[model samples]
Target: MAFQCQRDCYMQEFVTTVVSCCPSELKLENNGKKEKVKGFNVILKDTILFPEGGGQPDDRGTIAGVPVLRVTRQGAEAVHFVSSPLEVGLEVQLKVDWDRRFDHMQQHSGQHLITAMADSMFSYKTTSWELGRQRSTIELDTGTAKPGEIEALERAVNEKIREHVPVTVKVLTLDDPAMEQVRSRGLPEDAVGPIRVIDIEGVDANMCCGTHVSNLSHLQVIKILGIEKGKKNKINLIFLAGNRVLKYAEKSYTIERALTALLKTGADDHVEAVDKVQKSVKALQKSNLSLLRDMAVLIAQNYKNNPNRGNLFCLHRKEGDNEFMNIIANEIGTEETVLFLTVGEEKGAGLFLLVGPEEIVEKMGPRVAELLEGKGAGKKGRFQGKASRMERRGEVEALLQEHSRCPHLEE
Candidate 1:
């Protein structure tokens, strides 16, 4: 086995919380740009704070009472940048947010266990692992793993978490003879030092260079978000860890309460409540559609009886959905050449236009369209446009009646 000398890595502490934290190892000397004051991560020889590596988010908390913005690894070193510079050599008692740390542990350890189970059961390997803000995921090498297989693997992994297995962290060199035992050699190429292998005794073993809880009991729960086909032969899994689980629980509770109150139902009666809501919504929609149809008929009947019908009768109004205008035009269009136009439901707003027969449109469609003004235009022997206000209706109707281009064109 290759020995890990302090000189080889320039940074490596075999013991945990043993080395002096280099809070001012500040790499970016004169980065040319200045920072807006405080809040940053730091590097320490033996940091109790886990950095953002191994698909896990970094631990967040106060270092000597100063808030730690984030934790990250610089090469082979684990660093913790704090809000204020801690007294250089002072060994600040590092405190990690247990809730956040534990949640990440569950998701991370859960991923290893599930991946191992998948490999053992279906011979499907885990390609990669990703722990997101709200969810954690492990991509399996194959999509052929059935739902039953997924269920079995999930059950088995959760069972392992429940069993509270011992997570052993063994530091080994690259030249170690025992590398053959590592089933998951998922190591990054740049990790060229004493590799820390976290072995979930009797279950999963993988070469990982990330912070982990001492025991599996720290992981309270492993929630599987869902599995979907990613690429050819690849499956993606999304899941949530630690405090995020509590957040999700709270969110689900809020939604449940709102839904229950809205449906006038109890919390436990969700399915029936949903069914009731669907039925009620459908009934209301039917009633609304019926009312709309009646309104259209009524408007069209009036436009027909108006008696000031002209060949180029354009009945454009901001009444309702497009169906309303079409309905009105269809109703009166059958009796006269009517061109109905408008922008939307707000009456006296938007624009309007109307054109009768091709001959009539050619005669006065352009002139009327010009008078309507404000970015309105029509062509193809049709008067078409939107108006700035509803007052242009008289001008539009007068134009059509005076044009009197083609009476026969009224269809």
Candidate 2:
């Protein structure tokens, strides 16, 4: 086991000797394939880098200026994985990423206080917790939390923070009478030796291995974002603490400013304004679709007057969609005509459809898709699919025209 500083978590620097360093490789199985990754596993006599555990991320920093990529715990040892190797018995300098460490400390400590407060108030024990980059979540044992209950819990947690209670850690044996008295989530069956407990003055004490802030005041404030349903009737409480709360407020203000200007409304009226705009946009879309349908009918009537029309009628429209193509074909209302229509610009790919007699469609639909390097299917006399190789679409049209004139040309 490594010697933890125990004095203060904010202690940023240390000098330690490398106990051992090994050329390490991690083997991962992905999609039935074995992959090996090259790295180094390092051990130090004393380290300030906290390994990733207890639902909190590992501390990131430098070991003698070489980047420490990851850290993990095996038994009592905290293994530091590095990109480059360090020699055994070499004395080196260590540095911790203070900003990341402090942020984690705030969130983890805030979670502890919140969990304690909830358990005390309503017997809602914490099942699990996750510290995320933007927000954190605490899963409670209960299925639901009303808005009033949530507000009260937030108030109680913030009250503790304002009290500026000192957060202290104690190390004790399993047999110690204090062990039975402290509130713990419980210990692992295989656990041995001394257990570390975090005490928030008179509020609560629980066994925790994660780093924390020295005082509750450092938590700044605890804000409950919302509560969501979790697995098997549990409630997941989303929250932000300390610097995260300030960051969230800044982003919210920026978005609100943009919305107010775009909607020509005050900040408080933005939601109402947005609702009105959405209704207007939906009505406009319905009007445009009706206009397109009317235009399709006129085009089909004009095409029907052509004396040069053959068994195959091919058309392309840059602005057309599947609905437009289908409407025009249905308006023609002729069993003598076979329709091959494509939409979207020639420079890009788009949708296409085939409608004709069942025999002709079954024979030619697959051929068209093959030539266009796309896919489709048919039932009755209709086939539809997306085509990517529209640059060769002219060839598809010519082939269909030939087959329409002479059904046995290439068979």
Question: How many clashes in each candidate?
Answer: 14, 0
lDDT for each residue of candidate 2 in 56-77, tens digit (9 for 90 to 100): 8888888999988777777777
Task: List residue ranges in candidate 2 displaced over 4 A.
Answer: 2-8, 22-37, 188-192, 315-321, 332-338, 344-349, 357-375, 379-381, 387-411
lDDT of 2: 0.86
Q: List the residue pairs that clash in candidate 2.
A: none
Question: Per-model C-alpha lDDT, please?
Answer: 0.63, 0.86
In model 1, which runs have C-alpha deviations exceeding 4 angstroms? Answer: 1-46, 63-66, 77-95, 223-226, 238-258, 264-269, 300-319, 325-411
Per-residue CA lDDT of candidate 1, range 6-117, in tens? 1121122232332443434333324786445444445554555666776777777666666766666666676666557655556655556766666666677667777787
